[model samples]
Target: MLVSNKLLVDNDCPMCKAYGACFTRFNLVDNNTISPYQKTNEAFVNDIDLDRAKNEIALHDTQTHQTLYGLDALIKITTHKSQLFKAIAEFMYPFLFRLYKLISFNRKVIYPSANTAVGRDCTPDFNLKYRLVYIILVALFTGVVLHEYSVSIYSFFGWESSWFLEIVVCVGQIIWQYVAVKAFRKKNNEALEYLGNMSTVSLIGGLLLSPVLIIQSFVVLPVLVLVGYFFVVVSLMLLEHIRRCKLKKFPTLLSASWVLYRMGVLVFILTIFI
Candidate 1:
């Protein structure tokens, strides 16, 4: 159609600010042409609702006299020039829309770290698919570790061992933690974030055991094991506290339950190899 229009974006929005650059990077749209919504957004915000215009990507086509919002707006602008991006956007639109809503819904919890004065980096991604991919990878890595440790033990008794139980335990921890959180106090919208955070912190704790396990190969280091356990426990508590504070929830029962389950998992696995 070759219809001409400038993309209007909320300057205050972190996503809007970031996407402005993305348009240029994709080479589908020029950065200069994508105008801040503050100037012209007011023109059509009443039609689309001011909040909608600010929260989602909004485009005002001066030539066609039309306005587009949300993921559609992004697709229209970026995919116009590239069939590859267009196809990709179609494939991931549903997931990306959900991810955008997650971030939009939980701006308070995720944005504070990016303090302008302190220059702390922002953590903006809450893409559910990305989180799923991450957790699975972590779980798989942990599975490999558990399998190796289990096989080593079986060699002494000349008995074969399967990682089935160990793999289940490794993956079960993440699911159990989510169930605990949902059971105590459900934050339906934050479920993905909850799972993602749990997986991330658990993976970190699991990695800490890697070093301790390596040391245990030569000499039994009880002190190191205790220290590793302490670090992992403290880390989980700290993360839960921050998560609660950010989500404006005061329920610690779920947090405590999650911690207990993780600690239990660690102990159970330790007994298997030790």
Candidate 2:
């Protein structure tokens, strides 16, 4: 179900570029037509509302010269593959549209966009509601994963893991980072953005550990194996933190503070709990 459509995606956003590639890869649209709005010609760009396209993706119909935005564009492209999906999409439009907005609003914060000097920068407007929703959702997810992982290792420490404690710690990390950023950087506006990036790192670390948590549910794995895997995930997270910090142009001390917070937590756990 190939459509004669061109998707103008935010080139600076990796996720947007990836999906654009996917549409072509899966034959939902033509390979050559998936153009970056940043690099798209001025004449072609005039086909759609530029402001709306920045907030939501723009899909241009080559033949009809019609443009659709956000979930409408995606549903149109994807539903072409199957009638069942089309029916489901039609039924679930409201929920799916909200979900799409959530992701679209937070996409830049999820992965900060690269510098775009050549053309239109398709950065979505910062909506505090969406930002907080993103942060709270990731915090909850990370907290739950931490609570489960902590319980798995509780036998070694002779302590029980509390969901409340883990959730508090999850929140505390955000607060701690926010305080540190404010204290050092002194930029109130950038703090939220920095916290968003930090939360993303936490989310990635939690996601990495989720498989081990799942495996533990089925089999009784050794404590050393669990700890080893956790260390590996932490190491990967460290690399990610460094990469993100570089992307954000944040100081090395912020990364240092990140490590310091975990180390402090480790010390607190070993001394008091164990």
Candidate 3:
């Protein structure tokens, strides 16, 4: 619901401005109520309550008789297109309302504003240089893996038969990847963290199955292979989650390079046994 006032308004609210920009780009202006209201019978708009509007922006859903104010209004405004925003609104709106109430209750202590800017500085400094270095290294490793894969595919002698050695190599690779991911996450690199967590779990599973693959050979190998394949699938799911999270950038090419190295090590072990 939108209430329009026929008063010249200063574009002050950052959240409202950002949402308005998004709405403009989306061409979703029909439902919106902009200020300096013209005398028209638009279903979305009603006469503005100056006192209520002065406190915060108000939105009323006529169908539901649901009214939203302040942050709720902002969230409701964003809820039309973005599912992520809707989820956030549903989960966080109550919490925000409570916080606002608490702050309003303790205005002096919480916000000692002497008619000046009274907000926490929440600027993001994305240290892209360090991230670039990390990306480059990962890319180099990926290149090595692709090269190795091409070489191995062309040469039948490159195939590995020793499942134990393959598992061991996989475990080692996973551990290294995990360490890299932890480091990245420490710097708030969520994309690396997701990949690292997935790889760590997969490697741990592979490590557990390594000894079993060695001892039981024919009996355990098939079962472990199936289990290992399941881990791979889960890892892929985690990767998809990471993608959806939109952690600034995509995972580096070197993210799966360890797998190629493990493949090479497995091939060498198989050759020795043959």
lDDT of 3 at 160: 44
Per-residue accuracy of model 2 over 1-274 as CA lDDT, tens digit each = 5556778898888899898888788878877678888787676667888889989998888778899999998998889879999999999999998889889988877887557647777888877887788889999999999888878688676787789888887898888888888876776657777888888888899999898888888998988898888899999988988888888787768888888888988887777675
Candidate 1 TM-score over all chains jointly: 0.49
Error of 2 at 266 (Å): 1.8
**CA lDDT, candidate 1, residue 94:** 91
| The best candidate in terms of lDDT | 2
> Each prediction's TM-score against the native?
0.49, 0.93, 0.26
What lDDT score belongs to each candidate, Candidate 1 first?
Answer: 0.61, 0.84, 0.43
Residue pair clashes in candidate 1: none
- Per-prediction tally of clashes: 0, 0, 0
User: For model 3, what is the alpha-carbon lDDT of residue 67?
Assistant: 52
Off by over 4 Å in 3: 1-19, 28-32, 36-47, 60-67, 82-84, 98-274
Q: What is the lDDT of candidate 3?
A: 0.43
